[model samples]
Target: MPENGRTDTGPTAEPMIRLEQLTKRYPGQDRPAVDRLDLDVPPGEIVVLLGPSGCGKTTTMKLINRLIEPTSGTILLDGEDVTRADPDALRRRIGYAIQQTGLFPHRSVADNVATVPRMLGWDRKRVAGRVDELLTLVGLDPDTYRGRLPRQLSGGQQQRVGVARALGADPEVMLMDEPFGAIDPLTRETLQNEFLRIQSELGKTIVFVTHDIDEAVKMGDRIAIFNAGSGIEQYDTPERILTEPATPFVSEFVGSGAAIKRLTLSRVGDVPVPDWPSIGQDTHRDERAAAVRAGAREFLPLLDADRRPLGWVPADASGDVLDRGLPIVTRIGPGDSLFAALDAMLAANSSAVVVVDDAGAYRGVLDLETILSTVHTDAGPAVPRPGTVATPGTV
Candidate 1:
């Protein structure tokens, strides 16, 4: 590992982005905003520049796309020196999104999304098709939202449109500067999930900037925790940053409650799914009662004919099991993080939550006890590092 904790992938694998002694100093300023920094961002991964306010994370992002000229140093994109490339051309190849959304007030959503393709001189037919495709990709209905102005949309909607616009020409790389920071908490979370889904599909190389540690942990494949002068305190995966802080600054900046934060690193699918007693919604009363008596569970999961969970039924209850059972207000999928499973349980005030597949078919069950056990396992809370040996009792 490099002194900054950044893994060197060696000469055979060229990074999508490489910064060698990159520095940005402004006139009349005593110190440089971004001190000489060396960093590498592999292709098809999200590398987050995380730090406190004014730590130059944003500046580093801007430097990547030449939004601001660097005082001196090399900026390589796909092994080509782009430090002195045409600013406009370089930016066109890099998608950029900021906290403000930055959509044109006078333009319609479709028109805004078409900005890059239009600039690239794509014909109207192709541009229009790309706009519609991108709108739908970002969860906006083209027919309903295409003609609407930026002012007419909600904050979350505007951000979605902004993202659509950033991806206008299908750039290989994207720069996001706290894109969801201005939205409401619930909406912010929804957008974050949506973006992650999109990234999984597109696999775009991304450099995301944020001061929020939780956001960094959730979004980044690797995080560069910056201190003042753009110094990288720790450049490693979120699991390592939380489990093994490189410096006192990183430990303090990561803050307390690391055990809880580690939960985000694991997904529901990573844990063993426990089988729970279940009954079909249409089972006869006698049959249901007999099955309940046969099992030791107090409550049995109720499933529809299609095998999707409906609710939980008290095993001893009489009459129709479906009508008397408690409704399942929340259901999670394999892709959801264990943190999300825990949240679902807490939000529904239940000790267990239903797990489903992509088609919403019943998979198994995740209970509070399983989550606790996973957290307190001998292997330590989070997943083991790539090459590290686990202890004898470790999971």
Candidate 2:
């Protein structure tokens, strides 16, 4: 056994599921659906198979679940040869979710979720309990949603049921083919977030196929990019692919706004936040004036007695010290996405945003210039210089 929770004995550790010289061809087709594919998905990892349509990403996923028999090559699942296993028994142990949901209209939500467990000869009580548990796992309240038919629910709800059903048997391996593709953008994003949260705890070895580069970047721990004829162009993490494309084809496929996409992955608390002059609301007018004069950005953040951010006032503008600055309706917290910060800035029509802690204490500020600068440089937080313009990037 490896020590300190590490695997060893060689430089390379065996993957949970490995595809060796995997290929697929259809009769009368001009080319193979999947060609000479070699990929490794480690346990407790998500490997997104990303490419344009007809790239054979779906075919690769289908091969794993035995929906499509591979023309050649072997599939090793936990070092076991699945090619010789019974397809029916093999599929029961592997969960599958797809774009259309594929829920049975005649079956209730609970029944749909209970399909695999029942097929596996689980007791009726056990299947029912597992159905409720899986539904709750996917954020559906079994008491409310269990009896509803597929058509009674909205598209998003149906997709949730589909996910719950796929996870019904507690499978260690999951295959998802654009499970959120049919839903609207907002719902799709919500599902993606919820799914990621589930994956974080469950740690299922997942093969997710998608044509959307943004989805791949958001969902993948590592991504495999497929080219024409189902050939893998590159296989690497999202960070590497975004900052360093392996080839011209990858650069083109990722499209423009790659940098902005990286911002979505960043959190406000990941980088060091700078400090600026702040005056307690209870402070005397003269002290407030002094703080304003010492402010870094054009505005000074007013804090309460506890140093919690209240609002802002122009550093140079004169006003009643007791009277607060412009009312800030929106605030960004440490957990907020940088993309969210940019959106908040655009919505507020402000050049800079005040950063605050959970207790509303002033942390720092963010602006376009700061975000742009951080993207280019690897420098740490800047020390405050009185009367200096502050740009908090990536903080």
Off by over 4 Å in 2: 1-13, 305-307, 317-322, 358-361, 378-395
Compare the candidates by lDDT and give the number of the best one: 1
Predicted structure with the largest TM-score when compared to the true one:
2
Superposed by TM-score, candidate 1 places the C-alpha of residue 118 at a distance from the truth, in angstroms, of: 2.7
Question: 1-86 in candidate 2: lDDT tens per residue?
Answer: 10011212211656778888787888998787877677778888788989889888899999987799998988889899898699
List runs of model 1 lying over 4 Å from the truth: 1-5, 8-12, 280-296, 315-323, 378-395
Model 2 pairs in collision: 370-393
RMSD of 2: 6.8
CA displacement after TM-score superposition, residue 70 of candidate 2 (Å): 0.3
Output the worst ten-in-a-row residue range by lDDT, candidate 1.
386-395
What pairs collide in candidate 1? none
Return the lDDT, model 1, position 242: 84
lDDT of each candidate versus the true structure: 0.84, 0.79
